[model samples]
Target: MVQAVPDPRRWKALALLCGAFFMVILDSAIVVVALPSIEIDLGFAPSDLQWVLSAYALTFGGLLLLGGRSADLLGRRRMFMVGLALFTAASLLCALAWSPAALIAARAFQGVGAAVLTPTALSIVTTTFEEGPERNKALGIWGALGGVGGTAGWLIGGPLTDISWEWIFLINLPIGVTALALAPRLLRESRAQGQRRGFDPLGALSATAALVLMVYAVVEAPQAGWTGAQTVGLLAASLAMFVLFTVIESRVAQPLLPLRILRSWTLVGANVTMLVFSTIAFGMPFILTLYAQQVLGYSAVEFGLSSIVFPLAVTVAAIVGQGLVLKAGFRLVATAGLTLLGIGCLYLTQVSAGGSYFGDIFLGLLVSGLGVGLTFVTCSIAALAGVDEREAGLASGLSNTTFQIGAAVGVAIVSTVAVSRTDDVVAGGGEPIVALVEGHQAGFLAATILAGIGILSALLLLRRPPVPSPDQPPLVPVAEHADD
Candidate 1:
């Protein structure tokens, strides 16, 4: 394991970590509320707008394995500084972007920075706090971040966008700088001992290429016609990359993704449930933001305030969820959480153009976010439950990779369904407002279906949760993470 320096004020360091991590997650969600504003100011085509979000998610998810490994070999604090520099610079570029391509390109760079920054964060936390209850409490707080920090983007983005859409990106500047300044002084340098310095270039290339191609195809398919020649060609190419990725990783002496990791039923179950949960968690917000603003006639500030229940519910539920985990075990808590999430998503279908936020939107989001909070905390624990310290960084990376990738898929698929359904209704001579509301209903209902599958997966397969190690585990192998 990368060695950690003990500091009396580790909690302060944690604050910096959480702040940086919050920006990483916030970027993923903040852009949702800014979608309409960005579209108008940057003049993005409806089909292309999702790229701003997808570009970041695709790169962030794709390169995460490499990033996690790098942190183990290259030094966690060192990589954090590098990543912070890149993320801060990218955020500035995003704020200054003048065109859709420019913004998307900058966003992708931001994704690269995020890929480097976020996965290593848990590593730092684990090392700082030690194993057992202290780490668990820190981890619980870390886990709870999914709700408030992730969804906080929606609430914060609105007020910022009201000033100017650029504020959404610019807001990261101060947070990034503060973390950068504090991290060096507060966060001790750590890396795997006697680690090799070489990287799996081919593995990184193949994985990133595979995810980007797949996401591109998914995002563009509806507009391109699912069976269109271009769509088919991209799909084939993406599949080919996946095949190549599998072949390369298996043969490589030091693979970016060790295929053996998948053998752990504990990690596998946690990842699968995480992927499903994030798919709906991320997508539902995008679907509702559009409906609230365009159809329900809410202003940006109003929408942000009205949506506050989600984060509030999440905060309360996450703290309670940690206690539940200690008492009831992961299996029961996760299953119950997913069940509530599914119910919330189902309730969202009842929303109408004329519905009240207090009665409809607030209730649905509160239930959904509460469940999300509980499940996120438990999943975070379960993901690393059985992992040795040596595999801790990698396991954490895999968990986060699934989440970002799932979110990209969620948004792309849900938006395609909503856009296509809305178009169909408009063609049928339905009122535009009514059509939009129905389209949102379809997306919300789709989240319920996905959540139902998650619940089933949790109930049927998640019987084995990660058991806590009495002591800290080992760090990644040096040979696999040779310094770049």
Candidate 2:
């Protein structure tokens, strides 16, 4: 009864989808390397510069579900074009801005556009490809976008910043335009057919507001003392908003996120595992970038080049990992990957103040990066597996939400620990470089523990699909785990 997508065009659609996905991802990393340039050009105090990242991240992560649901109502292809146009326009705004206010506002607009486009792209892919190894293969490549974008941003940022930081923002314009032009020709419009109501406006509002406040608190907690009134107040308010959101969703007939969808242990397990590993993976760039610049005295270009290994490893692993998942199954491959990641992080604890990259860091980077590569690809497969087609967009949104929220929480927690430890050592009259390296190593030790826990979680919570009895339904419930 299901109509087959035009197979001949699916691959081209995927290339375009990945292209847009890559541009959105680049925004996340591009700002990190270009922060100094932006600070100088926009006359922002260093503190205000955090908003440059925060504004984008909060909006993107917070409203992802709303955007995803919007696509379910508005049609995926339509949403994609609108998002592309909005993001492209916002990029122009970002490039032209002369003030910190203008840039931050523009970044927020870009985030909204990205939040709209991201999950819709995933849902479109899920719909386009058949649900088997074919879908897995497409998803495997789709999974690479995060790392590819990160690596591309790091590699390309230095050159762009060397010319003008504006170029970093400007580069998105052409990519977005091309995607927009090809999208209507290549992508077909699809919406969930049986929805009782179109938009869950209230659900979207509360969720967006709650996430914004929470992410804002997380990003600011280190800058503002963790115990500061602002931090405490913002967290309390965010919690209240979240509670209200739950109540609203429960009472609403047509909820944006039906509470039932979240009852799936399969989706829950996938997201939890993602959170655990992502908490570790997300901090790697921040810690490594800091080490390269603050401790190693590397120039911007050198630091970017050094950071290339992780994404490169992830890109390679994701390609090969599809076959691995097919053979070994999701739980086993993911658990193994997490074990390797834990071991790699434990090994990285050996880094010293004057540690050589070749001797102390590069091997660990390669090892951890490989682990990350495998882990991420499997996580995607597991999350989407067993999800109802109607809620594929929802699942995509939730998966991304966990990853984004996890990253925000991880960076905050790790930064706080590292900064506290470094300050303590400095106060005791330790060399600043030694103190910083010691602090970074301590964070890595914590990351190792988290990664180890993720491995255990995978072993216990994940399972292959049970053989169906003839009396039972053929379709697996969203709550069940199944081999890819």
Candidate 3:
């Protein structure tokens, strides 16, 4: 048996890949702080403004599976470049958009590009690094970048929006172009070995449609009312499409997502944990954004600055979490992370209508940030731990898809809960500020419960340790591989 030569440029490639991924994650949250400017410049109706966000989420989440599978069947490097090109082009379109409709259309296009780009980029990382401690370290950095991208969006968006809302999208141009030029030089072309070119169009269509409808339903549920006809009808349709997707996958010679992958209890558990983790991770920040802007009367930039503690804590914790995972294993790290997340949310429930940032928001965010950092690294490692080389892209796609869906579900759950509570208080003629604070507190309480569920998911579902296949080395602690 012959061992393959390691790519000399792999580390540099990982840097580029992570950089591009950071941009994708950044785009998701950056536009959020700039929404008011966008609304004014484009004369968007309140109802239509959300579509700018939803458009990106819908396409990105929907196309991830297809994109991942395509990378497997096609060449990973080829798909990466293609996706990058599309994303960069769409960014330009978004900047140039003069009307709400144009911007929404461009944002959706941008998502299509992201859906293709994200999973493929992750697959590249897994393929580039050998499994075990080295891979875990790389993924830790990856997880940290995700946390930073989301946090920095608020920080960066505020100043950019002040200059001009279009700067947010325009900013991607140079980054994208530079990456495109560097990619061919750095990334080696690879694909699933011995896989035939046969494609599963029906399975792909059904799965993509199911995901798109599901994301749309959840994203719109708060506005439409959860029990309203539109919500129910869309959900039912989404469910039916999912059923069809499953049926198609079971029968197809080459399925988009092989059903057998679900048999891996470790992978399944990691994705479930990811979904639950994202609910709290995404939901808590959302409520805080409202609390800072609405209740504390902070401007976007001020809120961004005040909120910097969270990302800083997350970055430090994530680096530490990599070492912890390499020493203690996935289950312990994940469990501890969730415990902190729940405690953090519980602390946040003490927020008052007139609370100060240092007194109320800082500590909770810091605690939650630490938990987020650890849990993200743990989940990222666990998701691809025992995956086969051939299905690396599929695994990456599934992991990302879980995160995206979890984000949508999280925001919806919190928004619905908070709005209902706030409406009740307002109906009773309570002070608006007090009612708003109570609503945010309710949202934080919900996050605390979700974090608890995440802990259980980690304990129960991730019980069996990952068993490496015959071809690969078993995952070992960093101490064992320090010299590598």
Highest TM-score model number: 1
Q: Local distance difference test, per candidate?
A: 0.82, 0.77, 0.83
Q: Write the per-residue lDDT of candidate 3 for residues 1-484, one digit (tens) a residue.
A: 1234567788899999999999998888888778767878899864455567667876776678888988877878889999999999999999999999899999989988998899999998888888867887889899999888877888888788878989999999999999999998988777776688666789868876886687677657767888999999999999999999999989989888889999988899999999899888877877777777778887778877777887888898889988887678778999989999899999999999889988998899889888998899888888998788788889999998888777766766676677767877988999988889999899899999999999999988865446556876532211111121
Q: Give the candidates in order of lDDT, highest first.
A: 3, 1, 2
Q: How close to the true structure is residue 415 of candidate 2, measured as C-alpha lDDT?
A: 59
Q: Which stretches of candidate 3 lie over 4 Å from their true place?
A: 1-3, 39-50, 219-225, 228-230, 464-484
Estimated TM-score for each candidate: 0.93, 0.89, 0.91
Q: By descending TM-score, how would the candidates be arranged?
A: 1, 3, 2
Candidate 3 residue pairs that clash: none
Clashes of each: 11, 0, 0
Task: State residue 153's C-alpha deviation in candidate 2, in Å.
Answer: 2.3
Per-residue lDDT tens digits for candidate 1, residues 1-484, read 3343456778888888877888888888889998988999999998788888888998898888888888776777888888888999999999999999999999999999998898788777765676556666877888777568887888998899899999999999998888888887887666655457657889888878878877788777767889998788888998898899899989987788889988888678888988888888888888888888888877777788778888888888888887787678777888888988889989998889888887778878889988989989888877776565555667878888988888888888788888887888998999988888888888888888889888887876676444545564533222223333
